[model samples]
Target: MSIAPKPNPALAELAVLEGEWVIELSNAKFLPGSNSRAQGRVSAEWLDNSALVMRQWQWRRQGDLDHRA
Candidate 1:
């Protein structure tokens, strides 16, 4: 079996951002005739005993770009 690596000192410093966040887009008109608006969420967490940090994002509405990394 594989083992989890030790936590990195540098990764510990990023703990402050370990949580969920809401995203918003306004007046970022990708189209015409009106101001466009959208919303989504972003989440960050430690992986493998803080050996790495993983972040994922998703946007509201449609058109691809809807998955975890």
Candidate 2:
């Protein structure tokens, strides 16, 4: 049998950030383009009994392929 881990009080405050978010960047040097725009999505979730907030993001820059981490 497995027992669920208890939520950490300290991490509780970060729970508010657990949701989908939109990020926008303009004229980024790395993208290197005229009026370039970088649009990305960020999603975070609590893990290890709320001890850590893990995030996975993906982005696309003008004239560039999708990037993820």
For lDDT, the strongest prediction is 2
**Tens digits of lDDT, candidate 1, 1-69:** 987688888777788778888877676656232555566888878787664354788776444355444
**Candidate 1 RMSD to the correct structure:** 4.5
Estimate, for each residue in 3-53, the C-alpha lDDT of model 2 and write its tens digit.
Answer: 888888877778777888999888667767768889999898777665555
Q: Which candidate gets the maximum TM-score versus the true structure? A: 2
TM-score of model 2 vs. true structure: 0.66
Off by over 4 Å in 2: 26-36
Cα RMSD of all models vs. native, in order, equals 4.5, 2.7
State how far residue 53 of model 2 sits from its true place (Å). Answer: 3.5
Clashing pairs in 1: none
Give per-residue lDDT, candidate 1, residue 9: 85
Candidates in order have lDDT scores of 0.68, 0.80
